[model samples]
Target: MEFTEPKAYTRSLIPFLDRSHSVAKPGFSRWLVPPAALCVHLCIGQAYAFSVFNLPMTRLIGVSQSAPGDWKLTELGWIFSIAMLFLGVSAAIFGRWVEEGGPRKAMFTAGILWAGGFMVSAIGIHLHQLWIIYFGYGVLGGCALGIGYISPVSTLMKWFPDRPGMATGMAIMGFGGGALIASPLSVWLMGKFASSTDVGVFNTFIVLGCAYFVFMMVGSMIVRVPAPGWKPEGYVPPATATKLITKNDVYVYDAIKTPQFWLIWTVLFLNTTAGIGVLGQASAMSQEMFPGHITPVAAAGLVGLMSLFNMGGRFSWASLSDFIGRKNTYFVYMCLGFALYITVPYAGGSGNVVLFVFCFLIIVSMYGGGFSTVPAYLKDMFGTRYVGAIHGILLTAWSAAGVAGPVLVNYIREYNVTHGVPKAQAYNTTMYIMAGLLVIGFIANFCVKAVDKRFHMKTDEDKDLGAARAPAGAAQAVPGRA
Candidate 1:
């Protein structure tokens, strides 16, 4: 079988959209790159706020207007699930493409798919077709999420090689914060467009879609890959690095084969599983645990507060990793997360809302920190040669946790209830299960070691040769592939 290639016209145009080939103008500041990445991430991160639409979408017809039997929460639930499923799948599949194409092309394509997904979903909603919404937002939008999420990571890593943790933390921090911005923005938009005659979700989708398209386009235009072999001024690599940090490059394919990669994968999976489980039920758990003390509005406030902590942790913990190292950072997440999970049940049982909220906030911050720090962790283990692809493959853990977290939490809670456990105590079992998962994650962290030297790429013979071909001063600055 033969595959068709992009036409010459398309091929020629790609360089314009390719970050690697773009000339870095003199006096170019690497700091500008983070904001560009932020633009893409902040838009796509709206996926986390999708639940905000669930209730409104269900009421698309009857609550205020239209015919009966519009959509159910279960059906709407599939929209979020499908989006997450495709987010992981697309990231894994298209990761190499993103690496090859460069950030500009990848991000531009992401904008098209992400924003286009919304427009398509708008049409689906306008026409009252559930499957259309699924395909539009779930399939295409999810693909956009995956591509957009990883597009900036490698670039940021390369730009801030001396502070990989902080670089990635900045961009991924936007993702955690994206929901904070979008949740309120979405509610306000829906209200502005809504009426007794219509729920206004369709129009809200169209507006957000167009707005995000324009915003993401700005990111694509602004983002540029570092000049070949570029390094920060006056920065030096450690002469003798710790065991957790590798100075070798492992190709993405080779990376997955390494025990280190799978260990990190397990670490990420467990951390996310524990964090997302609590997040999935935050509002409901708040109300159930302290029925008389917490109102519906207060529960919503609690969820929002957690989002703030989540966003803050991404920046703070990841930056802290720069000083402490990636392995130790995750050690903090797993160990502290384990302790906090154990405390949640006690806090909830005592009806101490302050204690309960405090424990969850810390847990979520570590959760966000886990996400922001992993790319740097991969860079430490495998090197920058294929960090993006490695990171993309690792996100499959997140996709799995997206499903597993909620299912595990919901099932345990439901089982407890069915067995006649009190509503407040119903979550006790789930909390313990989460703590156990964290223990497993802590063990995985303990197992992580530097990749074997044999897995490292030969800088002269491999892809780093391109950097060697660069002009003199630039060539010396480029670090050898590890």
Candidate 2:
């Protein structure tokens, strides 16, 4: 409302603006940002590949005892969960910094802290200190998650204002695929460095920690946002595009006050919870349920396979959202996701591996799609002004889902284990619960109206002019990867 074309020149929240107030353009290339930023994403995606290291970390501590009774599964788990707690909380807390510091600064910070976390964990293993590993990995991993999650979406949207979903998807898809790379890497590193005699968990931890730290830093140098004032060549948002949220272009602060923010938050929370619940304990769940046939390692391989599904989903589903619109895509994911969850537990005595894999992969893609889609939705609803901040805030839902997902899967598995029911049957009960959450999400997605009419910023002149001056960065925003 304060923006005045005729009377005054003011700071604009548009992606690339300079001190002189001339519009900025993509400094280098928009499409280049995704591949460069994906380095950080792949590291954060290690969250999916967590189970690969859990066994080694646990054996270094809990399972090292001569007897089964000596170890506690609960203690070993605290490290990973503690890290995630920070991942969610830090994103919102540091989101402003992420925006101000520029993507390069943020990315470098993530690379150092995350890689250092591994080194710290390695030391903890060598010195036989469990708490140290918790502190080192927890805080550092949290930082990585915060930055990696935001970088590509923020940069991509700036470059590809018109197709925000596809741009974000291309970058985030790498994040989803991270576990695919990590699972194999973790396996190889563990095998190579593992002390043959004493369960050399310490040595393996050190080697891997160092390796990841070095690998992540390479990408940090390349990550950057576009120059100010860049828009795609020749294209402009129609008066139609401006009419939707133009007058209502609220600041991130103002957006939080609106109902739309909360509604979308709820949608993201449930979507993430449904996917993560299955993902966290997948291998263990698979082995426990199909103990006669599937080994934990094979089940873990299946989980890695799910990572491929997760990765592909981010790219394909989100790219599709650019065409179909985010709200509609979410409708499909949630409504279908609810049904998928319902089918999962009942996979039953049929011994159908194919059916199980198909169902799980669909769910994983939905989860990935939800993430890849939301930033564009944020751009649509909140305007680009505070979108990065708003999107960062929304990720708090992911943090919440992180806790909820594992708890739901593990608690049910534990309860069933205690009751002497097979873990597989117990998993069925959890799936039913997941179905209910997805139903709730589907309902929430239905509730998001176009940004309230009052918030629209399209003026008579803006309508007449109609994005004739869309910044130079627009061209960088290539279409969905066909």
Candidate 3:
């Protein structure tokens, strides 16, 4: 005898959160997807503005100054470092799951972790426990960052196959621009909540956490993947593919084995390493480089301006890549970056504040461009089938650069000062070293060739190997097959 499932059991399921629930029907606007992606990216992008909290947190107990028991700057610095460490780790570990599970599921999970992390950190603040904050925001929030970051990438690429670089630029640009909103918003929130006795960090965390969750959920609700075999109306495939742009698909795991993968990885690593060092120290570097010309307040403004350049570069450079090609784009970043880095020391020594600012603005723009361009680069090399997952693995380069860049900048400058170099010129040696690193990046970019055919997926089954992981009936539920 056939039995019907209980109504209560059926009611227990939340179909809205499923991957199939998010597939777009015929004529759904692909334009809607980038804003949805921005929802997740802008919120996660707050990581860049997290430094705003460091001083306030240190003053929590003291109210206006450091108390004997308050956390030190060195210790608090690890909050961001740990978050970045796990950002790369979680992305690499969960990337394949994100690829198979779909953007909606990944976004839902990210919203929860991202919001929950802030709540947990708020509790940590209430208790004055640093380690708890680390676990909450650094580890858990970082996982959210990794998931949220990659979630929209492949979806955007799929939606705009004709212009993958431009599509991704629109989404990733939100991440770079997130700091623009977060810095001021965070400061305002802290101001409103501040009192004589309370520094308001806890309340700020609680409110920001709740607010970010709402926005991220909206993104999740709005996002939809394209139907299987869907292409833009009137779009034409490139009749003749270049060696660099592969028409073939590669399995996620096999793509890593190719020399091209490592070469591209090195290209990203060196490029990131060269710029990231200066990005963190921009304010200090500017002030030291042009002592009388750039004040502390002016230095802060320079940092904010760099954020804009960084944000603009993500969209501009990535879109340019769609036209000029990804390989040529990196050639520009490395070549242009090397010249700028070499020139920075001279700009400082000659007291040319205008030239110094111009140099870093361009350099930081390329730094931001490198980030947004790589997903499309991976798409070109490995094929779109597994570009998101492959991109996730590649972010380990960023995690490494996060540590390496800061350490190199901080220690080198310190060593120079201790050895009798003037404060104004301490960064000169570091600038030359960065220029040298960019040369290595250029060579690595030159070495990148098309992925060998052996790395290509041989069967349609291999290409869609994990498609079964999708929820049953998802295809039927949504008009979109993919």
Candidate 4:
């Protein structure tokens, strides 16, 4: 192999950290990319399980219970909300930067912010300050979440052009499943570190920060972009593009200007609102709806099972989308999701725990599938050129739903209960409302059509911003090839 002399002032002392330096060489296997993506996604996915820290944090001052000086649960709730809000804000703002910069740079920045967020939050807990935790995990860590989330998306799609859905599903699946590992690990860590005077929240944050940092860095190190014009062996380009799947690229800003963008945004917003509200209230809703049957322990178990369904749906639904077409896949989500949401209250009323559980499992799975499939959906509607940035803008729907879903569930349930609706019946209206939202999503999904060609990129330079260029003499990339 030929080697070039090192430059006097390299972009990074470790050259691989730089985007240009991280290009995969000839013979590099595309399969390695998914694990690299998982390293970052799995670590960032802990955002879902951050709830595990909420209760423990309340007892930090009291050790055994919430004391006078302990932080209130209401205050702690803002931490996740703020993190989520900033996640969307940062994604929308920084999407183009990430797309142009390459995954390695984005992943590196995400690693630092994410790990540092944990470290700073740990300091906040130790000092008994709440805003510090918000600033740390919320603003800083939230930025990390946004960057880490979209970094691998376009890269994966380019690498697996034939199976874009499945390729992205593998990476996004790690994000959904991250809570599975983090929830139990966090509880065990707190148990080990707890004593009469401390609940170990601070220690747990520190450990998690360090551990996540290492994993994210590893992902950054291994990540690479496919050389431009590279296609898998024996993979022929589609001679004629489908109505939705265009060969042309759309600039990121132009994508936002399209009606299709807003439609997809609304579709995502509604789908997430329906499920996220229920997801946050799952444990309490189960206990209240099926009182005397689902104990707190069992409700917690249900939450864990929902997590699995969420994780599985991301992979399964996205892979299925590859076969069925993205539009048909979303139609299934909206249609079937509407039916499932409608059944939840009926199942609860009939006191059929099995049916109730089944409804939610499918519902939560669709929620996750909505997330994983959308990237490919955007790729279908818009071209892959600015897909990552377009996806970043789309994530704002998630932030809006994050707030709307939980608020709707909590306030509506409270309104009913205060007005003498039985606790068991409080969620009936919420379920109906969720079903209605799914109906709106279905309408929005139906409204979607092919994007106009007027918005398409006209020139070759406009299509690719130099990031896709292959290194000289490098062989074309092939999936699963070593």
Candidate 5:
């Protein structure tokens, strides 16, 4: 479908929604874009906190309620799984479309789909239909998550070419902290809306959907694309010739053809796989490791604390990447992450709670850092022209890791338990496996090299053709010669 002017009534409004037409005034600070990006991210980042609804959802048709049977945990797990699976699929499929559509249109569409998913879920809950809930939250909402997640990344990198890491980091960090804000807020809202006749989850969904719609619209309205060739005042592109940074553009279709893309994909897949493995079992791991010492409440608190590290790492490590370069940054993540995973068994065996928690904290922060830095890394390798689409395709690694990590860890633990390993020791095998994954990621990162000139969009005509095919906001003229 042509992104320029869709025939559908809803999509017809896209041109009006295009913020790129609004020229930035003189001295316009690029700083404003991060907050706008954050508005959308902070709202949609609530996906991380979806677990807060798991218990309430399972009981939706339970003994306490009027219905006959309760939803099983396994059934509810599919809800989240479906959402994540679609998040990757939609992101990979719609990435180029979003690039063609521009941030305003992309974010606006995401808001509608995400918010609408919740409202649909409310209907599903009211009707007590699992499939309806799946369609509503899993399919529609998951698409929203994918679109929203990548929406700000490319824009931020373009606006802050001088410091892409810091810019993207600021926005992506909201994704990590989103649970911090949403989890408690969901609990509070559910309680506030609850009454004798209702558990209040349905009402909470309605309220959250409406509230997110408004919040996301604020981002869509406020976000503006930088004019063609615009740059920050006094900013200068680095002069050093290195394999890590580039000035050439690669089309999205061409990006996937390169070995660099797959290498980075593997790097991301391994890092996320290892990190998420630990994250999925954080509370359980904590309690099991220190059977008598760590209470369930304390373990829960540790989970929350890990979130802080995850959020903080997004900003800190990404910013650090600006100085060290993207490849070096991943080297740190993989090498240190491997060491950290290896130490978890020791920490847990020795009953050193502080050391165990600290090790995981650093690991998760690096995990988040990996996410925030990858867009800039893509820009460094492929140029900003198709960064959005490239990043979108790359997120399939995340989708794969989402499933791979938990399943790998769980399977290992189960195997160990079956062999008479203690619950605390069960995680040891999993930790070693995670460390091995990181070793592979380290090798992938080490092997990364510049994309060959054959893949580069080499001519002015080629650049123009690329731009003309995309929406006005989606395409920008290459930065003018300094």
Candidate 6:
């Protein structure tokens, strides 16, 4: 029997919380699909690494046509932040279309816009037209962020009901790696063509823009969702697994009213604020604090390594969470993150490269883990009826982090520089602030209770999410199907 989709009231977007988990199909293997999915994943993942572009992006603006706050940094930030900000907004706006279009279609559009954003940003950078950068990459990339992020996350979970943690990790890991890829690529291209020594910023922009456009297009064209009526081979949804909420009952408007979303939002915001501050300013921080010891290129490379940690943490650590449980994993992430923040500055100040690398990686991994573990967390709390939209909304926290991270890092750095505070001392103070924020995040994560009855669609069973947290069929899964 075909499962009937629930009708959400005034809900333009319907999340794919298919209740049947009946995934009662023939034999299928979840492992076979991730390689193709990874392509789409890495491209979307570019958002994670966009700060790599910020690498002297501020300098580029300073030299291009304007001064610091006048237009350059502001323009550049607008372009980048818009992508993140819009990801949440557009996901809320376009979620139903994603369900209708399926992963393949959603990813294709995502691929196009994502790559196109680079090409467009390249144009703005090349021509030294700041507004164009905002218009092209900002708006377009935002759309890509919304669609690309959602494309594989839920679908992969459904297909690999048995390994939701691992499957989702593989795809989201690419996002973590996107920065790793972009950092090296951007640096390479800059050195080859723009060469901070000679080519100036505009030429560097054109070259990297073309390269990213090409690289991203290759990924977008290849993305696909599993065939319908498919399930991971040997997968089985336990008889105890059931739905607490259905689509027809909850609307986005209805969702915001509940305490669950707000609490989750706090969890997301604090986690992101704690980690992203370092990520955004990693290269600059490294350079400023260790100016006598590390070269610009080495500082940049360290940023790339953090990206590797970011990417690896998503898949590696978060997959580990599946067995350990999401809450337990988060407890580790926030608590450890707090400790890491405490040490980062001392390591930077003492020029302890080894400690610096270790602390930094741990911090970045938690950043990635936060993203990877959240989907499962949401499924556990609010139910998946509006997961895509809920996930989208949760990411608004990322946008907020974008603002918070850059501002906190840069502001502190500026304050220090202006005051003649040693570069090393500047970030040390900020690290304390970040650590404090993370401590709050730790407490918040400890506080995340299941959704209250008011948030349930039709009944209180939603509050009793024991087996309801599961998805699709595992035992009946079929090869090449979801």
The Cα local distance difference test for each model comes to 0.86, 0.71, 0.88, 0.88, 0.86, 0.66
Q: Which has the better lDDT: candidate 1, or candidate 6?
A: 1
Residue 61 Cα positional deviation in candidate 3, in Å, after optimal superposition: 2.2
lDDT of 3: 0.88
Off by over 4 Å in 4: 1-15, 461-482
lDDT of 6 by residue, 224-335 (tens): 4444555555666565533422222233445667776677678778888878888878887777777778788888789778877888888987688778877778888878
Candidate ordering by lDDT (highest first): 3, 4, 5, 1, 2, 6
RMSD of 1: 5.3
TM-score of each: 0.92, 0.80, 0.93, 0.92, 0.93, 0.75
Per-residue CA lDDT of model 4 for 168-278, tens digit only, reads: 999999999888899999999999999888898888999999999999999998998876556888899799889888887777888989999999999999989988998
Q: Candidate 1, residues 1-482: lDDT per residue as tens digits?
A: 11222232135455678443443665789989999999999999899999888888988878573347878889899998899999999999888667656788889999999999999999999888999999999999999999999999998998998999999999999998888888889999999998877777998999999999999999999897776667788988788767878777777777889999999999999999999998879999989998989999999898888989999999999999999988889889988888888898888877788888889999999999999999999999998877898899999999988879999999999999999999989999999999899888989989998898777775656544433443332221222221
Q: With candidate 3 superimposed using the best TM-score fit, by how many Å does residue 54's alpha carbon deviate from the native?
A: 1.0
Prediction 4 global C-alpha lDDT: 0.88
lDDT tens per residue, model 5, 323-348 = 99999999999989989999999999
Assess candidate 6 and give its TM-score to the true structure. 0.75
Model 6 stretches astray by more than 4 angstroms = 1-29, 47-77, 118-129, 183-231, 238-253, 287-291, 295-297, 345-351, 416-421, 458-482
User: The CA-based lDDT of model 2 is what?
Assistant: 0.71
Instruction: Enumerate residue pairs that collide in model 4.
Output: none
The local distance difference test score of model 5 is: 0.86
- RMSD to the true structure for each prediction, in A, is 5.3, 7.4, 4.3, 4.7, 3.6, 7.2
Q: Where's the lowest-lDDT run of ten residues in candidate 1?
A: 473-482
Regarding TM-score, does 4 or 6 come out ahead?
A: 4
Which candidate achieves the best lDDT against the true structure? 3
